[model samples]
Target chain A: MSERRFPWEAVLAFIFGAALGLAYAWVLAPVQVIDSAPEALRAEFKDQYRAAIAASYAANGNLTRAQSRLALLNDADAYQSLSAQAQQLLAAGQTRESQQVAQLASALQGLAPTVAPSTPTVPIAATSTQAQDPNAAATSTPIETETPLPFYTATARPTHTLIPTPGKPFELGTQENVCDESIGEGLLQITVQLTSRRQLPGIELILSWSGGEEHFFTGLKPELGNGYADFNMTSGVFYTLRAAEGGAVVPALTAPVCPAANGGTFFGGIRIVLQRP
Target chain B: MKRWVWILPALVIGTALGLLYGWVVDPIEFTDLTPETLRADYRADYILMVAEAYQSEKDADLAARRLAIFGSDSPAEIAASALPFGRENGFSASEISALETLVAALRAWQPASGAAP
Candidate 1:
């Protein structure tokens, strides 16, 4: 009968252990889930983060490049007193210091719009609203009203010259619309009418440009009854334009009129206009 | 009777301790970013981090944003949508340049590609 007694000490110890375990399990574990978050969402965050950094660097690099150019322009005596090495750079023609100077200047000036909103002090929600809803800007008075750059509308008409003309690649051209002046200093609005000799079913035209660095704009849907696409630009910057199809770059069917080297059937033209902003 | 007195308590205690640790410590150890447990749990801080990075507009922001985005396994649609946020909230030239590098890095990473990595 004595041996058949309830094990009071053992029972108490068991209860104590169970309680402690439960406490640890319930209280401590949840914090981990709260910390790491979901993986898919994590990836999204990373991508945005990267893009932000790249943009910052590019903007700053352009700013520095501009300041350097300004310094050179200020020093005429420096140019006159150039060493043989400096003179060689000028003669090589490979380094267009003058053009570079102009580009850097324009880039720096253009950066104002991008830079103002980028300040860390500014609330992201505020800027985000402004972007998603242009009208949302009215709710809060902006730090400063932006002087909207006037945009000019231009018409581009394309005329197909010859297609499938054996080695001639397709060709097309449109008369330049010089009737209206471009708006803003050093601005160029190019409206091009594009067409193919034959209806290449399921074909789309892609236009890409390399300015300060490679920039691309795709999905140029054809215009009504006329295959047309328009691209905007600011002058004094180097641009490389290409016509692409089926995920490949090909020469333009029609000759480009502006930049001298774009004369061949597949070659496109480059234009640089000097205008006051 | 003597065996039952100690054996039963020890088993119960051991089980309880195991359960407690399993519920608490195991999850955290499994999910943290430590090399061994990298995949134990998914993380979503990349989004907030990127957003905050853009808000900063400092040159460092761009680089930070890029680094955050490139290392994750986010969806394409979400990635595409985030671009305008970056553009409108533009930062200094250096920051923007960093963003460019970040884009290039993510582009090159090309994670698994279907929808989400």
Candidate 2:
């Protein structure tokens, strides 16, 4: 009987040992997995942040400090301080801003065109001179009639100078490509011979007059480097053009105007002649 | 009685196998990311890219930046801006609308720093 009891006791001890071992494998083993989870997530979050920064810079050519903040998601303390300037700029409306902060917040993000307009098609077999200015004297003209009989009469069309319309703003640039939408004022009517796309930095155009309300046009903040704007000036004001970039203004062009300001800013940086009604 | 004792070992082995399966392969059910999530990612990328470009290249000139991003104004400039925009944002209708607004605003804005005519 005693021998029988010993075997039963041994069986009970074996069951208790197996239970303890199973508990360790089931509970303790998964704890390690749980421990590694946050780290893995943190790494993935970092990758997402970097990808965002790279995309933003590639699209806009500049990064708002706020964007940089988003990239540093792991460092919330640093993000708050660094993004202050960007927040202020947005508040001040200096930069074109978006309503959403993160893609996770909404489904409608990135619906805009990824590319700008396609290149315009130029006419085939067109000569440079003809293509540039067909009105030049060297271009072909209709033959003159010899019979003085008709007492030729020529109607003269008056050439009108461009002046800003009241309450309208003028910007610099020419026109929009067929595919891309035109931003800002498009001086499509005026022809500009574009020389350089770069800005003439440190120059400011000031409105000076002998007697009138003080007016000025300075400190250009470009949205996308497509075009810029200038104020319409009244006749008899001394107009001084200056370039300003990186926070300093430098003189670039100055003209004493006895005439009114030209059409709303011409795109592509060209001289434009406005028509009078 | 001794033969039945073997049952204990088998039960223990089975439990161990179950635990291994649960820890390694139990929770990995497949679920794809939705199209909506992808769309959100795309939008986030575009806005952030535009904002960055405006700040750096155009010196924060909204009009010029828009032109650079949208490629409006002369075909040549448009082409130039287009490559960048396409490579980054790809052609989309919403981008076109944003470009339109930018052009309108710039055209109407009389810069404090007068741009040469």
Candidate 3:
């Protein structure tokens, strides 16, 4: 008579081989694709493509073509995508890009006419405050001086009457999430731009969350961009972003989950973009 | 036959299944698609958008640089390639005109093909 032996060793070998093969196939030698449609792009890359399309529309002032390009993203609602991106770029502190996306979205909605709207007169109040704050502005202001010192403001220009427009609302244009562990918890990166896409330096950004409110100004890091400022956040707090200039309230901002560089995940950082929409 | 012989066959079968699962049934997704692989209609619209931008910016050198993303094709050739597509697909005369304008600039343009920035 013969006795049957269990095949436990063979079963163990099969499991080990399967794991090894899967690791090799999926991790070591995955397929390499050189081409893909913009519609099929990963989320972050799709954001970049939307920005380029917005920029191209800005340069061309062609609504039809802009719409056509937006279609390539295959968004169910191109306007919603543009509007969403406008906020994201703003929250990311990309003032120029945020304005471009906002303008493109506006144009698509027919609110911003594709016809180059005659340049709105610069808010005289906004201009004077920006011009006086910089030492380079001294050269622009042009007084008889032998040497201009860095960070020096010329005192002679009489302050102009604060126009009614300075009192105008800034209207929150966009707010976006940025999840990077490098940006410490509850960080808010803010940038403001004019309708013309020029960064609006010196305007104040006010943050009010739950029981507390704080304020800051752009141009704190002019090297970063004209309208740039940052704030550290505390965990578990909800925040609202507002303009000290009477308008533009972005409510309900909180940190979203973001992946860490070291294979961990954390939740923090909100970027808000504000402009005279 | 020895029990060890059965082990080798089982291991081989397991590996084959695993490789099939990873390579075919659940392959990694493609995320960063370059511009060259766009569908034909999308490609034409992109060129037309470039041409529209050219109309306003009037920067032939810049337009040439943008078209260069397609690789291995002269900017002029790329613009020209889109015209037939534009016409067949009911592109308006003005839209077609923008494409033509781009082609003209690209044709005469050079490293001193002499289109102004």
Candidate 4:
């Protein structure tokens, strides 16, 4: 009878072949990805994109485009995301970048584009001179009128500057305790507007309770109202809210107590309205 | 000897299958992409954004820093490349002007603290 032997050599060869195949697959020729959407960017790169958007918003005060650009990230809550990012930046000692982001957040919070008609897109293309940059003129591509992105028009529009470098100072117009159970965990809602009732954004405020002080801005939640901002409050904590450095001060503010649909009680909220005196 | 005859063919077949799977069946999906890989049109728009911000800030250094996110391109060259794309792609003339201004600033820019090598 012929002696049978294990095919160790053939097995070894197959193993070698598989190893070579995997190396070639994983390293030598990996696939190339291009034309990726902004949403697909890595976390750090997304933050970078957000920073540029914030800076552009600061430069032009075009909240609409800024919001649209931010929407590309598909953040669950753009305002909260921005505020959190600003806080992160501040913690990282990137003070100016933080402020830029915070300022944009505030202005965006206050704008009610749907109702205010504040940032209307008026084309500015006609204002441009025929002269182009020599370098750009030389290497121009074959021009095609492609409208880019969602809701973007081909023409450049004049910016409606919402937050002047230092906008008009505001004084407390009204501070009321809203004992409503529906506004979620009780809010310290603040509304800021011009004397003419135009919602004012970019107004800075400081909120302090016994052991902690936090600074926040208006227009961070424009859907609520442009020039509107709010913070959550704990049931028993007393707080003091002030605008700018020495502007109007509202003291001894706290979350109110309200009747719930069930036989239970819920925390209420504070509503503070600020306007130019 | 019979098994040995199949080893080279097996290796070749394995390599072909691996290449097909890697390049076609399941191409590597990127979860962490930098701005350098942005689509041509989107890249142009991002450059336009930098130009708009430059128009507002008028700080070439900041513009350069923002442009630096592209990883490889010089700020001026990056901004310059966008202008032609912007012009041909329906970016308003004023937007084109903004791109021009940014490119000029980047070209003339010198580091404030002498970090240039």
Which runs of model 4 end up more than 4 angstroms from their true locations? Answer: A1-19, A32-42, A60-64, A71-77, A90-100, A103-123, A126-160, A163-203, A206-277, B1-13, B72-74, B113-117
Q: Model 4, B4: alpha-carbon shift in Å?
A: 8.3
Cα error, candidate 4, residue A188 (Å) = 15
lDDT sort, best first: 4, 3, 1, 2
Query: Candidate 1 residues A182-241, lDDT tens each?
Result: 322222223222232211111123444342433222112223111223344443344433
Strongest candidate by lDDT: 4
Off by over 4 Å in 1: A1-43, A56-252, A255-277, B23-25, B28-117
TM-score ranking, high to low = 4, 3, 1, 2
- Residue A225 of model 2 has an lDDT of 22
Candidate 2 CAPRI category: incorrect
Comparing chain B with the reference, what is the TM-score for each candidate?
Answer: 0.29, 0.26, 0.71, 0.73
Best by TM-score: 4
**How accurate locally, in lDDT, is each candidate?**
0.31, 0.30, 0.64, 0.68
Could you give candidate 2's per-residue lDDT for residues A40-89 as a string of tens digits? 23333333333334333333222232233243233344322223322333
lDDT by residue for model 4 (A1-277), tens: 9676776665566667766766776787676767666767898888878888887666655566677678766677877777667766755766656767877665665632211111222334243212212122123421332323223233332442333324445677887777766677768899877677866554567889999998876656666765687898887999998875355778898888877889798888888888864
Q: Which docking class does model 3 fall in?
A: incorrect
Candidate 2 TM-score versus the reference? 0.22
The fraction of reference interface contacts (C-alpha pairs within 8 A across chains A and B) present in each candidate is 0.19, 0.09, 0.49, 0.51
The window of 10 residues in a row where model 2 chain A has the poorest summed lDDT is: A127-136
- Give Cα distance to truth, residue A15, candidate 1, Å: 14
After superposition, the stretches of candidate 2 with alpha carbons farther than 4 Å from their true spots are: A1-22, A31-110, A113-277, B27-117
All candidates in order of DockQ, best leading: 4, 3, 1, 2
